[model samples]
Target chain A: MIGRDEVLHVARLARLALAEEEIEPMARELSAVLEHVERIGELDLDGVQPTSHVVASSSKVDVTRALRPDEPRPCLPREVALAQAPAVSDGGFLVPSPQA
Target chain B: MSAEVLALSAAQASAAIGAGELDAGELFSFYRERAEADREAGQEGLNCFTWVAREAPGKAGTRVRETVPHWPDTVRMHESAGSSLAGVPLAVKDLFCTEDAPSQSGSRMLEGYTPPYTASAVARLREAGAPLLAKTNQDEFAMGSSTENSAFGPTLNPWDRTRVPGGSSGGSAAAVAAGLAPWALGTDTGGSIRQPASLCGVVGLKPTYGSVSRYGMIAFASSLDQAGPLTRDVTDAALMLAHMIGRDACDATSLAHPQQIALPSAERLDGVRIGVPAELEPEGSSIEDGVRRCFHRALALAEELGAQVNTDISLPHAPYGLSAYYILAPAEASSNLARFDGVRYGLRAASSSKVEGATDLLDMYTRTRHDGFGREVKRRIMLGTYALSSGYYEAYYGRAQKVRTKIAEDFATAFASVDLIATPTSPGVAFALGEKTADPWSMYLSDYFTVPMSLAGIPAISIPCGLSDEHARAGANGAEANGSGLPVGLQLAGPAFSENKLLDAAHALERAIAFDSTAAHV
Candidate 1:
């Protein structure tokens, strides 16, 4: 079952801005979710390998090989790049502050 | 329009377009206008989209069809996946990056961010002549069962204003259900597409992993996410899926499997075998009464059409599916979501505004992430991070992986007995808005049936079986798709890479229910 503190903590982490009225209802609902998920505890998985994906027939890509080749790609002009910027000063794009 | 034309499956649409009665341009506009109207009606509630594609100047969503990639081996796809449907009006879940549109993934952090290149799936869809009409809404990073977790407001169910559209693909399903788009694209990781489909009363398919490219789909659980279509019917879904499928060099995990479905052939279910689980699916445990009623009716209908149905079968470790899914999905999500640190790609809060022009990198990262992600997403990332942490890794993530192995074994055994295991897509139909929003556990439980398939990476589709009484009240918001009679969706699953039989069985049963039951909503 979901604990109230856990729910509140999760909400705080998620930045949900949930009101006081929502906590208890959420706790109750979350408890149901945990209970349902706990149903998995009923199975005997002593030797079972945990399967994360359905199809398991492929090799992982080499991270080093993923880098784009040195083929010279076209670059947009500096002014063209800054054209869509909402605000620009000096050689940089400026953004508005969220706190204000 | 002839009933045949209106009734045209995706395969049929392409064939008809190829044979030349309907103009490809006209077909795209017909659906686009419908989508435009759905958007207009649903603007305040569904939150179905963040951005609609600007009107394509030359094509009107059709000009690029002549450039569609040739697919000779799959004629049905070439017919449907390649033509008007390719250029058709449809929405993509905003989780995917598009060159021309913003991909918020339901977060404020990435608000207004448009990538330089489109996702691979989007590129393939475009190459096949389908244009991106709109960016459908989704849960943040595809993390939650409901779109309620979106940093953007929740996407309401199209069928009932007061209810939720199931998520993280809720917006896509609701858009198609509300007739906002001819079809829309969505990702399914633990029932993301299918659950919402059941709620909205439309067709939602989660193709087997590797069946479709995940290269462009924004990763939630990298191993589990499979992009599929929310079409009005199974055949259309198959056709569109065909065009978007094939081995992509970009996706290392993609399957080079060759399993092409024959649309309209779903009408033959005689030899089709279905497995009913004994343990994982207890009445009142994971299923509700109405879903069961419709499931029984569907099974009976399939039996009437000569299919074999097995009961009391043991999917022995299947019960552990949910536990395994939670551990694995979050572990993957934690890893996938880490890329959003405030350096690039999305919105950034003021580095200059903090404490009188104090400049530091740490504050920027913390403030951006803290403000950008929503509650469910943040909770999941933390949970995933905890699961994957050094001390907890073996106890949680490792242990969960072992459980996943067992779940897969049980599924393999069950499939050996029969081709598919059938169950209600969602426990109950769409619940009222905010009913389960506060409770993350309940919201997670809503994905019970769907999560297992994602865990096993199997293909499953939710086809409307019947509707509820609430469907009658759906007319208030111009819910044209809410049939006067309630709609129920019958799910069909097949062995990995065996979408042919799955679609075939579903199509056959769809027709047997009535040579007359062939119908489409918005």
Candidate 2:
């Protein structure tokens, strides 16, 4: 069972607000998810080094390469690239408002 | 062939088309007819799809112009397409963006939201010769074990109407198993692809992270997710893999090393050594007797094929694999899924419903994510946020990462001696729909044999081992083991970028077992 303060804390951590009506239901769901997480906590991992990269880091393969000198390359024409744009002004494609 | 051409595996279709036995157009129409027929049969009951595309395969501009449905339709028309892969019909997991169809990703939140660009994996397939069929259903945000978590309703397993097709790649598995398409693309994070494939008794490969490009895959658990091929046979799977891999500028984790992978042509069990983890096969774990017998039979077949099989290998840290995976998967998922904050991409709750201009962008994010994502996805977000939050971070998320490291190390220590790890892909055959829903423990346990590989970021595939005698004895309704009555799977797994070898060994078993005709759907 989760405490009232614990429920509120989970909601805040998850960046959600719960109504009084939703609190009990939300608390049950939250408790179930946390219980599983708690089950994950039973493991003992003393002196084990953490692995961030799934692929083994290699000095040869993973070395940061020097920036290549600019070479002439094929490029898509601006007009063709901009053909699908909804709006354009002053040689620039004008996109719609993300807020809208 | 009447409708048999469309149902043929990638290898079969390509071979026949190249041999002048079958035509690409015939293969296209067979699936076009079947997809239409099955949609009619399944749309009401299975809920296995979000949207069906209006266009048929073999059209121009489908690779880049259409949604990133894997293996573009246009390339199949190329005469050179008959080289490696001539024609294989494929279904896309709805999570990937497809231009012609809506990329809903199984959420009411993104209903009818078409992406502006096609994903790179889909582009690669189009460049190869495979035809893009349709988009299959998935869990909202690819979260649930059963595809029941989809906003559109659950995807029922093809074999039994009541049981689930394991998800979030449920529809992809179902489409392949029920012969809607020869193959499909599925994203696996913590056994999304493997579990569904095991339940469906089809071959699903969760390629090593970074082996395949995620340039167009919708993010669920960033650290864990990898796009892979799911097909009726390992040969078809290998051909599909050869088509959709290599480095991509759009994805940083994309493999710098892209080596040509040969499929069943390269399958060699001779001189191969296998490791069987003792923990997975331990008695009384809900793994049915049929699965165990089949696993043993597969092992014996491998041994008979001149492979050395080792049993009783103890990777003790593997015992904690599920624990580590749950923690890291949810932790990564929480952070990655925060992008759907109703600000940039997807739906936002209406301002009129808000408290008279009091709510802002943050309020909109909290409301949309809280309401939009399914219960499992939401539950994970909350649990992960709490784990990543201050005061609890060191105790939960931090320690889980440590356990994850230990699990990887344990596998490395074992793999030093053995070439690959083998287990029963699932503990048992598919279960009833509501059977495990009441208890998440059972649901998590469903992937017990498979999760360790996902946590280690290795490749794993499930090939049908044998059939369930129990289901056969009771006739039609006894158990929903699999549509083909196969209850067994030889869960083959290998370390990162070891797909070529894994596919080779899986092909060896596929031939040795000789269940291809009996096991394949339609």
Candidate 3:
């Protein structure tokens, strides 16, 4: 069973704030999901390499490098890119100051 | 005649408009009226649309042309002026970025956020002259099987108002099923498209991974995510896909297809060997009796249609697909979603007085995400973070990826002897609203059959095979039941870049089944 400390650690890593009362339930749910997926750990995958993507090119070919030439091109205008920002100042995104 | 116009398939609507039999504006108005009527008349509410474009769509310089310079020159047209899908009114799932409409991705985090640019698929569709109808609802960040995870509200199934329209593309499927629009676009990350299409009785296709560009679609699980068409039938799906595919410099992952894909024109599936995995034999507790009956019925129809059905196939590692997907998808999600901190865009939580000194950036980040994201989103984020964390990475994410390799190898071997593989799109018909919400594991299991295809990065389609009569009998009436009955979907999947073949087989089976359902006016 996953403990409250574990759940809180996960929430912290995920940058989500959990209320004190929500911790027990989150732990229970996460534990259940982990238990369900635990079957993968039991399989014998000796010498098998992990697949990052189904489309990732094989060893003989580096197909990803063949994408369009890396010349400088027109991109999203600064104003348009920043149009959705919740807070912006001096032609840039604004955020709270980092604490000491 | 207006109702007839609204019910026209994407192909029929475009052809009619092009042939001068139907006016584009008139056809758009008919669909808009039906959609508005459906929204207003429902007491429980269909809740299909997040935002409906008030102005009619046409050939125009709508917004960007007025402000941006050199806009027309940068835009590329892959198809000629006379594309088949010209002037078809279509709905887009909120996940895709549309320049004219808000793309909230069914989350409060981006409640009113309109993207600066349209998604590549949306741009291609627009260039082909398909009008934007409305932005449809979905599970917040495409996290849930049912659209119950939508920040606004759940989109009820058109087949039965009391049940769910399977999601995170539920709104798209429900919109098409209810005749609000001829078709809609949906993104699938672990069965978001096919499962909902199965439940709603609409035809949906998830093209091969990287076949369609993911440039402006919101990220869920980066490697596993894909966008596809959810239409009334296979032909419409084929037409929509024709315009929506091609390589884009904006998205490096897009498949290289300088030339347009030519769909197979064969009417018969002669000599086509369809592998039926023994593990998914529709027996035991997980498979519903009605679902099993409909699956076998579909296969039998295929046999009669000249396709050689091979039921002796075994995918030993396929049954473990869902387990691996649950690990890999959430891990990627946790990493992809890290950008939503209360910094660049989206909602920022107002600091509360309860924690007097919690006015720092850390507080803002945590509080914003805590309040903005829905419950299911949070659960997945937590699950993902836990799996990817240092101590548990090898036991969980590492093992999951290894298993994914085994699953992919198994599919490669199966395809060596078989032309395609078949399965029931979902375990059963659409369940009652809120039935599986309480149990997260059960909800995850809903994508059991569909995830294996996503894992293998193959093309798959879900076509309406039949209806669950038992579910129909339990309903109050045919109209209140939404249409004929709850829909059952048959999934046809093929190896990479096999979309044309997959669509051909699905088209043949669709003709043989001839399943029909239409939602009644409330």
- Could you give candidate 3's fraction of true interface contacts? 0.71
Best by lDDT: 3
Docking class of 1: acceptable
- Per-prediction DockQ: 0.23, 0.27, 0.58
CA deviation > 4 Å runs, candidate 2:
A19-22, A39-44, A57-100, B42-45, B57-62, B66-84, B266-268, B281-284, B351-359, B471-486, B516-522
Tens digit of per-residue lDDT, candidate 1, span B214-268? 7656788888889988877777787667777765655666655565444545455
TM-score of model 2's chain A, to 2 decimals? 0.47
lDDT of 3 by residue, B1-522 (tens): 866776678888888877989888887777787677655654356889887867676552232332333233223545442355657878999989888688999999998888777887887787677878888989999999999999988998866777889999999999998888879999999999999999999999999888788878999998889999999888888888888876666677776543365543666788999999988832123878888889999999888889999988888998889889999999999998898887777888877212235376787789899988988889889989998998889888888888888888888888988999999999989988899999998888889899988988888999999987767623333344434556899999988878878888888888889877454322
User: After superposition, which runs of candidate 3 have C-alpha atoms over 4 Å from their true positions?
Assistant: A57-62, A66-68, B39-43, B58-82, B281-285, B352-358, B473-484, B517-522
Give the number of the best model, judged by TM-score: 3
| Runs off by more than 4 Å, candidate 1 | A1-47, A50-53, A57-100, B1-13, B40-46, B60-86, B280-286, B351-356, B469-474, B477-486, B514-522
Which has the better lDDT: candidate 1, or candidate 3? 3
lDDT of 2 by residue, A1-100 (tens): 6767887787776766566776676567667656655765666667766666566431123513423336554444565445433345566644334253
Q: What DockQ would you assign to candidate 3?
A: 0.58
TM-score list, all predictions: 0.82, 0.87, 0.94
Cα error, candidate 3, residue B37 (Å)? 3.3
